[model samples]
Target chain A: MTEALASAATEDILREAAAWRDAGRGVALATVVTTWGSSPRPVGSQLAVDQGGRMIGSVSGGCIEGAVVKEAQDVIADGRPRLLDFGVTNEQAWEVGLACGGKVQVYVERVE
Target chain B: MKRDLLDSLMQAQRRGTTCAMLRDLKTGGQGLYINGEFTGDFASGPNLKPLVLKAISEDVSGRLPEPYQDIFVQVFNPPVRLIVVGAVHIAQALAPMAAMAGYGVTVIDPRRAFATDQRFPGVTLLNEWPDDGLEALKPDRRTAVVTLTHDPKLDDAALSVALKSQCFYIGCLGSRKTHQARLNRLTRMGFGEADLARIHGPVGLPIGALTPAEIAVSTLAQITQVRRAKPAAPQSAAA
Candidate 1:
């Protein structure tokens, strides 16, 4: 059997975010700034996105990444950050909320 | 996020220095907070630095408290550390187990034969007196200490250092009788009831583990319980 590595550290994601910027790709970093209830990812969990539609890391297990990526690309285009809130109680709950019914505040900002 | 600032933050992170990435939600500006120094476009006054510092030290990442509500402090703490004093069969099982669970494991034993690379390949082996070995490691808030030598000379010295420091977990392997005797010794040595209470005598979840590997699993499981389990009700925060 293959050995399972330890939990992937935040350094790996941040390093990838930095490398993308250095390579001249427009990258946007989405960080889960806050979480309430049963969030799969912790408050500091992140999702890195490039303008090319590639992504790394995650803000939620799998439920909210698509919406966060779309918002991230917008931030990359405008060079202005935006915060997206998702939860069972939100107005856009059905379309983008976490399946685990957790609440999270994701701050998306373009990497300069 | 500025390229230079990200580079500097990564440099600090690589060096195992605690750092925080701060963002002003109102302005969408991001910066790095490392070693009490702020590097970024946003102005971090006296009021903001301590909040970031608190977040880093507490290993909590979230919005700043009242008055500084606009900032989000994202803490990046160094790896959680585990120091096992003994390097015996239990340690041989425990060291790699703890490492797999994301703890930076260090095994301390003055006996070179016990603390060797043959037994512990990637684990940090400190073949010094337990107290001296622990002191050199400079146990911090993120550290966990376990004494399994079954020798008071080694276990007591390690306990003295661990109890006095902010390490999150202190476990000593011993039975009820041995634990009571250990407590008596520490009490006589000037540790009060509150200080002595921190030691997890028998040092593992009471699953009646018979083998060294099973004991290691129990100990590591207890460490996880202490590390991840919240002290109070989660309901209040969710509310």
Candidate 2:
């Protein structure tokens, strides 16, 4: 069931990215390419962001969407893809909100 | 001209066809593969073809081989469907639950009063006879069919059609005696014991369900169990 939802989300991300590009809005896509330990979302899960910071779908359930969206804005601006790593840090665990103690690698690229 | 890969993929999804999209990370090339053929223009060579086929067959998405490590293959499969024959009380409950579980549900009953939009909101309602409705739906391997109308005139036709199709689950609501009689009838209709065994008559897990909603839960649970059961697992041995 989670897989099905992820697949649907991937499709939605692609559709939304294409629509944003067609409408002349800068678009970038962030995909969960790899994860270690108890990541909330699985690999292939995606989150799409347009120039105006409008977003759809998710790479992490909730722990790091804000961070991804923040980075996605940079990817859309510079047109340079970025690889982001998020994990629990002793002092920053509370700040990152990743209490589950897992690491996630996200690949954010401009959809051009 | 670069073809719109997303548009093509959306079309394939709407048409219920299995397809895969492969993307190269380094070079940013993309290709759409469908029905054993590659349609879009991409730079990945023939070496990655087998991996694409494997991904589609497994219905999974992941990175490619060593040389193509940067590439990603994403698979798309049609949505699962559930067909409930007989707009009985159980159907009213099961349809919504199945829909919530991501199944496209269709309720069929010849009785107009029973098969109504009011009774089955947001479900596809067919006031046609069972056999005709099943024929039209053409239940496939991704489909689950449940017959709740105890009347053989309705259930027998639904069962016959579902049994012959590739539907993953087929259940009929009845008691043990009624199921035995149903098996006898189906046997007379030339269905072998092996074929009849595929059915879960006296449908639903024996959870001591007393109400319509509880029965619906049991039925849906049994269907999900059958749907996800690993075929290689020994069934009788587990029992």
Among all candidates shown, the one with the greatest lDDT = 1
> Candidate 1: which pairs clash?
none
Query: What is the lDDT for B37 in model 2?
Result: 78
How well is each residue in B126-163 modelled by candidate 1, as lDDT tens digits?
99998899989999878999999999999999988888
Once fitted onto the true fold, the runs of candidate 2 whose alpha carbons sit more than 4 angstroms away are A1-25, A34-43, A51-54, A83-105, B1-3, B39-44, B65-67, B205-218, B229-239
- Model 2 residue B108 CA deviation (Å) reads 2.6
lDDT of 1 by residue, A1-112 (tens): 0111122356778899988888999999888887889888887777899998788888888899999888888899999889889999998997888888889888998888
Candidates' interface RMSDs, in order? 8.1, 4.3
For model 1, how many clashes?
0
Task: Give the per-residue lDDT of model 2 (tens digit) for B1-239.
Answer: 02376788878876768787776666666788887778655544665678877776555667776777787776777667889999999999999888776577899999998998988877899999999999999998878999999999999999889999999899999999999999999999999988998999799999998799999999999988897655785658654
TM-score of chain A of each: 0.89, 0.87
Clashing pairs in 2: none
Q: TM-score of model 2 relative to the true fold?
A: 0.77
- Distance from true position, residue B204, model 1, in Å? 1.9
Candidate 2, true inter-chain contacts retained: 0.12
What does the TM-score come to for chain B in model 2?
Answer: 0.83
What DockQ would candidate 1 receive versus the native complex? 0.34
Worst 10 residues of 1 chain A by lDDT: A1-10
